[model samples]
Target chain A: MGEFELIRRYFLPLAGQGKSRSLILGPGDDCAIQRIPAGRDLVFSVDTLVEGVHFPKYYRPDYLGWRALAAAASDLAAMGADPECFTLALTLPAADEQWLAGFAEGLRAASDAFGLALAGGDTTSGPLTLTLQVHGTVDEGTAIRRTGARPGDLVAVSGTLGDAGAALEYLAEPAPTPDMAAMLDRYHRPRPRLELGRSVRGFASAAIDVSDGLLADLGHILQASGVGASLDSARLPVSPSLARLKGDASVAHALRSGDDYELCLTFPEDRWGAMPESVKRQLSVIGVIQAEAGLYLDGTDCSAGGTPSGFDHFRGKG
Target chain B: MGEFELIRRYFLPLAGQGKSRSLILGPGDDCAIQRIPAGRDLVFSVDTLVEGVHFPKYYRPDYLGWRALAAAASDLAAMGADPECFTLALTLPAADEQWLAGFAEGLRAASDAFGLALAGGDTTSGPLTLTLQVHGTVDEGTAIRRTGARPGDLVAVSGTLGDAGAALEYLAEPAPTPDMAAMLDRYHRPRPRLELGRSVRGFASAAIDVSDGLLADLGHILQASGVGASLDSARLPVSPSLARLKGDASVAHALRSGDDYELCLTFPEDRWGAMPESVKRQLSVIGVIQAEAGLYLDGTDCSAGGTPSGFDHFRGKG
Candidate 1:
C-alpha cells in the first residue's frame, strides 16, 4: 500500500477520538494545529526506543508499540498534565503488513488507555525504532516540577517497582520459569499512572515518572530540587513476581531497574495522610526528601551517591 | 560519559538560548513547558531520519544533524507557522563523543539559522536515528494548509528544484567531477524556508514543503484541497547544476526525484505582482491550481489520473 493509504487506514481512525479542546486540527494536514487554553501551559516530551537496545528483537510487535507509547506518555503523567496528543516517528527496515498491523494495534490500545490521540507522525524506512513526542496541557503555574521537592517532603511511588526490570532480565536470558513470563509481561506493558498523577498534582510537591528505576529516577527530583533523599531499603516495594525471580536481590533490582513507568512523587509530610484514596491504595511511601546533599539507604549512605544511575544513552546499562 | 553528562555538554547549551516567547520552560526538567499565545494556534510536525534509509550511512555527522532538523522544520514552513521550538529523539548504537560533538554542532547551526531553540529531547541506544518534533505558532485562521487550495489559484514554488535529487545520484555513484561534489552538498544540506513561510502566510492559499519531489509533494496539496493542477514542464526551475546533471531528462528528475525541501504554494493569480521582490527572485511560477479533478502535464493527463509519479516509501528507489 502507498504511504498515504497506510496512514489513512492505520492512523486516521486512531486520531479521530482525540477530544482535546486544544486540538483544532489533528493529522491529515501539512501540520497539526492545537490551541492551548488561555490559562494552561503545554508540556512536551520525546522518547525513542530501539529494537535491540530498549527491547529484545524477538518481542511481539504489539507489545513494543504499547510499551513505546506508554514510555513517552509516562512523561506527561509525571508532569501532572492531561494527556492530549502524540506524534509517532517510526522507522523500519521495510514495510511489513503483518508487523504494521500488530504495531498499530498496540499503539491504538495504548492511545485508548491514556486518552491520547495520534496527531501526526512520519513513517520512514530504516532500522526498527519508534520515537514518540507527547504533548499535554496543564494549568499555568500549577504543573508540578522536579525542582519543587523540598526538605522533609515524603517521597512516594505509585505501584510496585522492579517488575519491569526483572522482566527485562527474563527476556534477555529466559529460564523455564512461569513467573518469569509474568515479569516479562509487566516489562512489556507498563501502565502509565495518569490518574494517579492527576489526583496527586496539588498534593505532591514534585513529581517524575519512574522510568530509569526508582533510585535513579527519584535522584532527578533530588538533584533538580537541590535536596537529598533517605530511602528505606526494607521498605522497597518489589513485586511478587520479581521476588520469585531474584529473591533477596529483588531489592537491588527494584531500586535500580528502570522502565517501571510509575510516578514517583513528593508531598509535604502534613498532606501525606490527605492523599487521595486512589493514590493511597496504589502508592507506598518509599522514602523522604532530606535536607542534606546525598542519598541514604536505611540511614546509611547508598554507594551510588544519590546521582541518577539510570539507563545512560552513551554509556549503556548504567 | 553518561547520558546526562553528554546532554549537559552538548545539548544544554542549545536549550539555554530562549528564542521563542512560547518557551515557558526549557530543558533540564522532566519535560519542557511552553505557552501558546492566547489567540494563536500551535502547528506541530514530526520527521525521522534513519541511517542508511534517508541518507548514506557514511554521510557526515554534522550534515546529517542539519538535514534531520531541516527536514522537520520544513513541515512547519509548509504550514506557514513561525518556527518555535523542537524536541529531538536520537538513537545510536553507542555513545561516541566525536559523533556527538559533530551532531551537536550541526544541530546548533540549524537551530540558530532558523531562530529556533532546542527545547528538550531523548537520547538512547539503537541504530542511528534522529526524530524531531517541531512546534510553530500561527495566528488563528492564518495558518496555511494543504486543504485550502481552490481552483484558479496560481501555483508557485520557492527556490529551484532537483538539486537535491541530483545530489542523491552523486552520493549513490560518485563521479570524478567537481559538480558531483556540489550536488552531494545540496543533498546533505537543505535550507528550510522559514522566513518565506512567515512572509507568505497571508498571501498563499495553501502550501506544502517539497520533500518527496515537486510533483509528489504538490500532489498532496491537490488531494487535500480537492483540486487539480496543470504544470508547464517547461517552466520548472532547475538549478544550473541540476540542468547540467539532467542533460535531457531534467523535468523528469525534478518531478520524480525526492529530497528537495522547497515550498510549493498556491496563491491568487492577481497577487503575483504584489509578491515581495525577494520572493520573486527566489521563487518561480510553475503551474496553476485548476478546476479540473486531476493533474495535467503540459495539457496532457499524467498517470494515476494526473498524479505526478513521486517517491513512494514502500516502493524504494523507483
Candidate 2:
C-alpha cells in the first residue's frame, strides 16, 4: 500500500477515538489546529528513538510503539502539564502491513492511557525511527521547572527506579518466570507519572523525569537550580524484582542505568510534609538539597569513586 | 561530544535570538511553554527528512538544514497560520562539529527568516535523520481548509512550480552557468509562501501547499473537497531557469515534480477578482474547480496516460 493508504488503514483509525476538545482539527490536515483555553499555557517537547540505538533490533512492534509514546509523554509529566495531543513522525524501512497493525494497536492503547489525542503525523521511508512531539497544557505560572529547586529542599522520586534497567536482561528471554515477565513489562511499558506530576506541581520546587539514570537526571535539576543533592544509597527505591537479584549491581542500575520514566522532584520540607497522605505515599525521599554544589552519597562525593554516570547516546553505555 | 553538550553548544544558542513573545520558556526545559492569545488557534505539523531517502547523501549541511525547516514550515503556510516556533529532532551517525556548525547556521537563518523560535527537541546517535515540528497560530475560524472548495472556484498557484525538480540535474555540476546556479538555489532554498497564504485566507475557498507536485497536491484538494479540476497545461508558470530547458520535460517537471512549496488555492471567481492587485500579481490562474469526479488536462483524463502521480517516499521517485 502507498503511504496514504497505510495511514488510512492503520494510523488514521487511531485518531478517531478519545480526542481532546482542544483539538479542533486532527489527522488528515496539512496542520492540526488546537484551541487552548484562555488561562492555560501550551507545553510541548519532541523525542526521537532510533531502532538499534534506543531499542533492540528484534522487538515487538506493539511494545515499541507503547515505549516510544510513554517516553515522550514523560516530558509533559515532568512539566506538570495536562496531556492533550501528539504528532508522530515515523520512518520505516518498508510498508509492513502486520507490523503497522501491531504498532497502531500499541499507539492507540498508549494514547488512550495518557489521554493524549493523535493529532497528526508524517510517515516516510528510512531505517526504523520514530519521533513523537507531545503537546499539553498547564495553568499559567503553574508548570514545574528544573530551575526552581533551592538549597534545603527535600529531594524525592516517584515509584521504583531500577525496574527498567533490570528488565533489559530479559528482553529476549523465552518462557520466563513471573518475576522475569514483570521485569520485562517494566522495560516494555514504563508508565509516565502524569497524575503524580500534576499533584505535586504546586508543592514541588522543581521536577524532572528519571530517564537518564537517577544521578544523571538529578544532576540536571542541580545544575539548573544551582543547588547540590545528598542522596542516601540505601534510600533509593527498588522493585521486588530488582531486590530478588540481591547484589550491588542491581543497586547500581537504580543509580546509573537509564530508561526509568519516574519523576524526580524536590520539595520544600514544609511543603513536602503538607501534601495529602495519598499523594505522599507514592514517593520515596531519597535525598536532600544542600548548600554545596556537588552530588554526594554517604558523606563522600559521588564523582570521586564508583561514579554512576548516566547513559549518553554517543558516549556508549554509562 | 555528548548529546547534552552538543545541544548546549549549538542548539541552545539558536534559542537565544528571534524568540516569539508567546514562547514562555525555550530550550533547557523539559517542555517548552507558550501562551497563545485568546481567539487564536494553534497550528502544528511534523515533517521528516532521512539522509538517502529525502536528499542526496553528499550535500551541503547548511542547505539541508534550511530545506528541512522550509519544507515543514510550508504546512503552516498552507493552513494560513503565522509562523511562531519549531522543534527539531535530529539523529546522526556521529557528532561532527563542522557539519553541525554549518547546519546550525542554516537553521538560525531560516528560524529568523520565517519568524520561528527554536523551542526544544531530541538528539540521538543513528542514521542521519531530521524531524521538524512547526507550530504557528491563526484566528480561531480563519484557517483555510482543503475541504471548502466549490465547483465554480478558480484554481490558482503562487510563483513557479518544479524548480526543485529541475535543479536535480545540477546537483553536482562542477561548474555551472548562472541559470544552473539559480536552479540549484531553487532546489536548496525553496521558499514557503507564507505572506500570500495569510492574505488569501479569507478569500480562498480552499488551499494546499504544493509539495508533491502540482497535480498530486491539487488531487489532495479535490479529494478533500469532493471536487475536480481542469487545467490548461500551457498556463503553468515556469521559472526562467526552467523555461531555458525548452522542452516537454521541463513542462512535465512543472506539472509532476514535488518539493515546490508553493501555494495552490481555490478562490470563488467573484472573490478572485476582488483580491488586492499586489496579492493577485504573484499568482497564475491555471485551472478551475469542477463538479466532475476526476482531474483533466486540456479535456484529456490525466490518469489515463500522462499520470503525474507525485512523490511517495515508499513507492520511489514519481
- For all predictions, the C-alpha RMSD in Å is 3.8, 3.3
Best by TM-score: 2
State the number of backbone clashes in model 2.
0
lDDT of 2 by residue, B42-152 (tens): 999999999988999967899988999999999999999898999999999999999999999999899888988999989999999999999999989899889988999
lDDT of 1 by residue, B15-111 (tens): 8546877898888888899988789899999988878778777678899889988988998999888999998888878889899899999999998
TM-score of 1: 0.92
| Top-lDDT candidate index | 2
> Where does candidate 2 stray beyond 4 Å?
A303-318, B304-318
Question: What's the lDDT for all of these models?
Answer: 0.82, 0.87
C-alpha DockQ for predicted model 2: 0.89
- List DockQ, one per candidate, in order: 0.79, 0.89
**Across the candidates, what are chain A's individual TM-scores?**
0.92, 0.94
Compared with the true structure, model 2 gives a TM-score of: 0.96
The i-RMS of every model, in angstroms, reads 0.8, 0.5
